[model samples]
Target chain A: MAVSFSRRIRSLAPVLVLLALCLVIASTNSNFLSVSNLIRLLSAAAIPLVLVMGATFVILMGSIDLSVEGVVALAAVAASMLVANDFTSLDLGFVALPAAMLLGGLLGLANGLLHVRLAIPSFMTTLGIGFACVGVATAILGGFTVRISDRTFRELTLGRLFDVPYSVWVAGLCVLVAWIIQERTRIGRWVYAIGTDEHTARQVGVPVERTRILVFALAGVFYGLGGAMSASQLGQGHALLSQGRLFTTITAVVVGGTALSGGVGSVLNSVVGVLVVIVLANGMVLMGIEPFVQQGVQGLLIILAVSLALDRSRLAVVK
Target chain B: METFREYLPPVVLVLLVLAVGAIEPGFLAVDNLLTVTADTMTLFLMASGATFVIMMGGIDLSIQGVASMTSCIVAALLPELGFAAVPVALFAGAASGLLCGIVSTRLRIPSFIASLAISGIVTTVAYWASDTRSVLIAAGDRDSFLAWAVGDTGPLQNEILVGLVALLLLGLLLNGTPFGRYVRAIGSQERAVVASGIPVERVKILAFTLSGLMAGLAGVVMAGRLGSGSPTLANEFLLPAIACIIVGGTAITGGVGSIFRTFIGALTIAVVRIGMTFVGVSVFAQQIVFGLILVLAVAITMDRSKVTTVK
Candidate 1:
């Protein structure tokens, strides 16, 4: 009973922290509780929420994907240009969304292949790929912003259903799909097995290499959808479209009680993590803290969260 | 294969210089070569320090932040403290690195995440210290104290001389010191080092401190050269410095590299960067080239047998 109770509390810790932060922020600023502000907060979290979901899977496999910002930037640029846009004559409309995601998936596939085939670490592979993606995005943009002029496409960001933006709904659907993949799929089980112990997983007949590749590709698809959402939200796209999202998304996944060592936490945990980070940022802004200081707080927060979430007993070496 | 791998970096350096010189004859001119050597000083400084960490099978992503922060400190304090600010900045850099070491070693966090988070914190501190703008050195100070960095002595720039001196000292330290041997051993076999009863944690901390000190020195020289400092001063150096280490044939998995190899690597990067301009490659495309080079180099040079799983 004691062991189970302690385990239950450990699982509930993130939610407890979130509630505590909300209550404290609400006490300090009454407007933080406003429904309109809450909606605004949720909308603001829409993009990062999507990004965190994708990163959660990669991190779940004990491999990191630093390609989020680059992939998102590329996807955003591609989506902006492919849809009814000022930069080019191409106008695929809704088709542009899937097309952008396809590009992202391809990039993700390359990342996985390079990591697996070459036997390079995932972080290094993703980091290099991310840089290359940024370069490609920049080259394609040619130093110009591609603005979405289609009102119908822009409605994905602007239109509200039950006072929540369509982007939020899209993010919600992604969360559901990601959660389902995490909890109800054979690939998801393989991801956990590999992350827990790759040699053991392979010995148990898990298709480790294929699963790793597919997980990265899956992450890319989410990043691609995120790029489309970002384009819709801002109604424009450039090479820097996904700036700073990488830090926030990774931080959110870690903070939501997901271990960086992997095989722990779930999609729902990342959702809560995204909300925690978003709420903290919003609350700090309302409290008149300097934006620079907020960045420092976030840095400290990640360190603290990772330290808390880390299970040190399983590893002989931390590095 | 072993002999070829050993000779690859120098051979690549000579070939790159020859290739670029062939395309742009002016690139080989004595004056242009001196300029390229001087241009590589900052990257050489950063990469040489990072080489030690990488040699120990760890990495220090905080060097860029440390460099930027130290530059900000030097720029902000130069008028009042003048030459004293340099040491202050160096101390700050060392302390920042020490913090990373403690967080990683004591808290048992991975150095990658620890250094990355610390980088964010230091960068913010830099932004706050500079009031989100560039801080300029006074004209009087620039001519008086800062001349040591920018002024040329004989045919070589003072910056080049500074880099050479640092290289010599670092080479001596790596080859002539017990600490150096321990660092290499720890990187190659941590379990063996621990069994040998060596104080592994202290050595790791000291290596990080050395990395931070070098970053600080780079920042000071950069400030002197630019005549101003901002939080973004070294923002572009991180990837290139990593490129320098890997392209120079330092195994990214650690334990098989030298500062001299990084020296050659830095020159190669400098040649490639400047040569691209002469060859009319778009500035935007250079990043792609560096990224591809990093992946390819790591793929080629990685010690695959070091780990059972490539996480």
Candidate 2:
């Protein structure tokens, strides 16, 4: 009974932290709870929220995907250039969205293949792929931002449905899809099994390699969608469109109670984690903290969160 | 296969040199070759230190951040402390590495995550210290104290000479010392070493500290050459340095590498970059090539038998 009770407390820790943080910030600044500010906060979180949702799957398998920034940058640039843009004669209209996502899936497929086939560590493979993707994006960009002129595409960012941006709705849809995959699918269960114990999973016929590759491809799709949303929000896309997002998204997923060790945490946890991170950033700005200091604080927060969420007993060594 | 893998780096280096020389004869000229060597010094310094940690089956991603932070420290303190600032910066760099080592080992966090977080924090410190701008070292101080960095010694540039000396000393340290053997042993098989009652944690920490010191040295040299420092000054070095280690035929799986190999790797990278320019490849496209090369090298040199599961 005590073990189950303590486990319940541990599971609820992230929620409690989010609640406590909100109360503290709200008490310090009453405007923090205002509906307008809350909406702004959600909008600010939309892109990262989508990103975190994708990253959670990779992390759930105990493998990391550092290719988020690169995938997003490439997808964004591809989407912008394909649409009615200032740079080129090409205008694919609504087709640009799926096209961009397909590009991301291809890149993610490459990332998965390299890691699984070559047996390179996921971090190194993903990091290298990320760099390559960024380079490709830069090459395509030619040192220019492709501005989107299509009103319908821009509506993803500007138009509101029931007082929420379309981007947020997209993010909500991602959460719902991800939750369904996690709770209702065999691949989701296979991912947890592989992360929990690869040898055992392999023994039990979990199709480790295929599942790993598929998860990476799935992650790429979400990153592609995120890129499109970002391009819509900013009205332009460039090689640096998703700069600094690698750290932010990874931090969000890890802080949301997902262990870097894998096989723990959920889509809902990551969603709440995204909210926590965004609110923390917003609260820091309201408190007048320097931007540089805020980065340092986030850094410390990552270390603290990872240490707290780590499952030491599962490992014979912590490499 | 073992023998071929061992000889691959030097063979590749020679091939690259010949290929580049074939494409552009001027690439072989003494002056241009000297310039390439000089350009490789900073990367060589950073990668050599990282080689030690990599040999131990751990990695130090914070080297670039430490280099940038120390560069900021050197630039910020030059006005007040003059030559004294260099050591202080180096010490601070080592201290940061120490912190990373402590966090990873003591707290049981993975080295990559710990180093990444620490790098972010120190990079922030660098920004805060330099007021988020490039801090320039005064010309008077540069000529007086930093002259050794830019001045030529006989035929070779001072920076090249410094790099060579670092290569020699670090090579000796790794090959001649027990700590060096322990690093390899730990990397090759940590569980066995731990059971054998070796002080694995202490050695790991020392290796990290040494890596940090070398990064600091690289930063000081960079500041001396450029006469300025900023948080982002060494930002571009990270990938190239990692590329150097892997390309030089060092196993990313840990163990089975040397500082001299990293030096060769650094030269290979510099030559590749210069060669790309000679062949009319756009500067932006070079990174894509390097990324591809990095993956290829790791694939070639990885020790598959060591890791039971690749995560």
Candidate 3:
């Protein structure tokens, strides 16, 4: 009973710290507490929030996806080219959305296949695939920016429902679906089992490879949707659409107590982690901190948070 | 057959050169070949440092960030301090690397994540120092190290000579020293090495620091090569450096590989980079090919036995 009690308290610690941080930031910059400012923060965090959710799935399975940036870039360009864009006369309208997502899923499938079939490290495989995606994005871009005139898509992202941007709503929906998948689904349970011990999981009759591939493929779908959403927000698609997202999503997921070694975190934890990262950035900006300085501060905070949050016993070997 | 595997990378490199030259006769020109060697110098230096980290079953992603910081520092100090700024830049790189090692060792953070954070910090520092602008050394002040880097020394480019010297030094350190043996042993089996009373943490720290030092020199050399330093100067080299180490046949699993092979790997990359341009391959297509090649190399060289499961 005492052990369970302590574990509960331990889990609650990160949320408490997050709340305390918010109060401190609010005290420092009173405007940070404004409803409008809060809304703005959510809007800014919408894209990263989606990416983090996808990354959460991959991390929970004890593998990582470093190809988010490249995948997004490719998806963004592909989406733009398929829609009512300046680059090509082809106009697929709402169909472009699914097409973009399918591309991302395909890429994710490739990532999974390469990891399982070729036996390459996830990090290396994702990284190489990411580069390939970037190359593909560049080729599609052809040294020119493609402007999107898809009114429905733009309105979907930029349009606010109940005084909040649609992007946030989309992010919220993604979080909801992810939560259900993580908690209720057999594949999700298999992800946890595999992460805890792949060999044991396989012995227990878990479909290890299939589950791994499905998780990656699902994560790719999220990344693809996130790319389309980003293009909507920016009102165009460019090859560099996913710039700086790799570190941001990884940092958020890891800091949220998702073990780098795997099998020890949740969507709820990452949501709180995302809020902390976003609020921190928002608060620092409000305090007139330089963007570059904020990055350093964030880096320091990750090291501190990771040090505090990680379970040492789980890490028998540090790679 | 065993000996054949050992010489494969160099043989492949030579074949690539011959193939490219046959396709484009101008690619074999003395000027073009020399240019390729010189261009590969900084990459060679960066990979030389990273080789040690990988050989120890760790990865260092802080190369570009450390190099960026080194370049920024070198650029800012060169106007007044001239050549005296070189060592300072190297020290900064080594110190940053040491900090990364401490974080990884003391906190038990994985080296990749630790290095990633370190890179961010270092890159931020570079940005703050340079104010997001490129810094240039006056042409009149470029006669010393810059001239040496760009000039020919005997039959080889001076930058190539610098890279050769680095390769030789790292070779001796890895092949003829206890430190090298410890690194390989630790990578192959950490529990056994720890039981043997090896100061594993300290050795890991030193290896990381040495890699950082090499990155620093690479940055300074890069600054001299371009006659300017931009905060993003080495951003593109990170993947290539990792690719070079792996392609040179260094096991990503960590116990087996050499600096000399990394040199050949760097050469292979340089040829592909320059040769593609000569052969009319678009820059984007080259990136695609690089990505493919990296996957191929890792697929070929990865030791399945060493890594029970590829994470």
Candidate 4:
């Protein structure tokens, strides 16, 4: 009983911190607890939440995807140009959404292929791919923002179901899908197996390469969906739409107790972590902290969280 | 013929130069060559610093932030402290690097994560120091340094000369010193080095500190060239610097590269960049081509057998 209890406490540590932070913020600014402020916070977290879900998969495999900003930029621009937009005559309407997701998947597949087939490090593969994606985005944009005119798309953010935004609903669906994948799937189990010991997993007949490709491709699709949602929310497709999501999402995944060395943590842990980060960001803004100081505070908190949550036993060397 | 693998990058670089010269006769001109070498100095220095870290099986992502913070400090203090701000900026960068080293070594965090956080911290500090504006050094305050930096001594640009001196010094440190041997051993096998009782942690920290010092020097040079500084000044150097290291035939797995190779690699990148300009490739297309080249370079140079699992 005590062993289980200790295990439970270790797992719940991030959640406990999240609650404590919220309580402190609420005490300082009572409006923080109000429904409107809460909704606003949820909406702000919507895109980052989706990004965290995608990042969680790659992180689970002990590899990382630094291509988020690039994929997001390309998908957002391409989707904008394809849908009812000022730049091109092509009007794919809602179909543009899936097409954008496909673009992201293709790029993700490229990343996977480079890592598995060419034996390139995921860090270099994703980083290079990201640069290529940004170039594609720039090429597609042609130095102009394409104003999105699709009414249904615009409603992705403005529309509400019982007072909650569509973006929130979209994020919820992503979270549900991610949770299901994490808890109930063969691929999910294989991910942890591969991360824990790739050599042993390979010896045991695990499909390491195929699983890596699939997860990266799936993550890419999610990033695409995120880019589309962001474009719709802003009513335009800008190539630089996902400027800062890479660091933010990675920080979220790590802070949620996902060891960088891999083979531990879950989507649920990441969700709690995402909420904590988003809440802290929102709260800092509410408290009138300077934007620069807020960034400093966020950086300090990331170092603290990672230091506290790091499983040093797993990392023989913290390279 | 394993030596053939060592010669591949240089051979490719020469062929590329020949191709560019055929396409644009101006690319091979003496004046253009000098300009290219000078422009590549900053990248060479940054990559030279990174070679040490990568050789130790660690990576540094905080160069951009450290450079920016250094630039900000130099710009803000130059008017008051005059030439004295140079060391201050260098110290600021080294201090940030030391902090990163402590976090990653003592606290046992990954260098990438620790450096990334330090970058954010320094950037915030930079913004506060500069008040979110570009700080300009008056012409009177900066002209002497600028003259020395941008001016040519005979045929060689001062920048090129500074870079050459840095190249030799760093090469000597990496090749001749006991610290360099320890770094290489750590990269190849940490357990072996630890068992050897070589003070692995201190050497690792020193490598990061060297990287930070070089980045600070780059910042100082950039400030001299631009006559101004902003928190975002060094934001664009991160990718190019890493690309230089990889393209220079340094293995991302570590223990298999040198500062000399990075020097050649920097020249290769600069040649390509300038050659692209001569060919009138669109800036966006150039980025695409650069990305492709980076991917290809890593694929060619990486020791596949050394990396059992590419996580």
Q: What DockQ do you compute for every candidate structure?
A: 0.65, 0.69, 0.67, 0.66
Q: Residues A204-224, candidate 1: write the lDDT tens digits.
A: 999999999999999999999
How far off is residue B245 in model 2, in Å? 0.6
Candidates in order, interface RMSD in Å: 1.5, 1.4, 1.7, 1.9
Model 2 residue A258 CA deviation (Å) reads: 1.0
Reference-based lDDT, each prediction: 0.88, 0.88, 0.86, 0.85
Return the lDDT, model 1, position A222.
95
Clash number by candidate, in order: 0, 0, 0, 0
C-alpha lDDT of residue A2 in model 3: 100
Q: Which candidate number has the best DockQ?
A: 2
lDDT accuracy of residue B207 in candidate 1: 88
User: Model 2, A1-319: lDDT tens per residue?
Assistant: 9988988888898899999999999999999999889999989999998888889999999999989999999999889988899998888887888988898898889889999998889888888889888888888777888989988999987799999888888888889999999999999899889888899999989999999999999999999989988898999999988977887897788788999998888889899888888999999988998777766776787899999989999877766
* Residue A55's lDDT in candidate 2: 91
In candidate 4, stretches whose alpha carbon ends up further than 4 angstroms from where it belongs are A1-5, B277-281
Which residue runs of candidate 3 sit more than 4 Å off their true CA positions? B278-280
Q: Chain A of candidate 2: what's the TM-score?
A: 0.97
lDDT of 3 by residue, B1-311 (tens): 44775899999999999989998898899987887888899999998998999998899989999998999988888888887888888999999999999999989988888898898899888988678888997776677646666667788888988887898899999999999999888888888898989999999999999999999999988988888887889976888999999999888888888999899999999888877887899887888789878988988887788777666
Off by over 4 Å in 1: A1-3
Candidate 3, which CAPRI tier?
Answer: medium
The DockQ-derived docking category for candidate 1 is: medium
Candidate 1 C-alpha lDDT tens digits along B147-257: 777888988899899999989999888888998898888888888898889999998999888888898889888988888989989975877888899899888788888
User: What TM-score does candidate 1 get on C-alpha atoms?
Assistant: 0.96
C-alpha TM-scores of all predictions: 0.96, 0.97, 0.96, 0.95
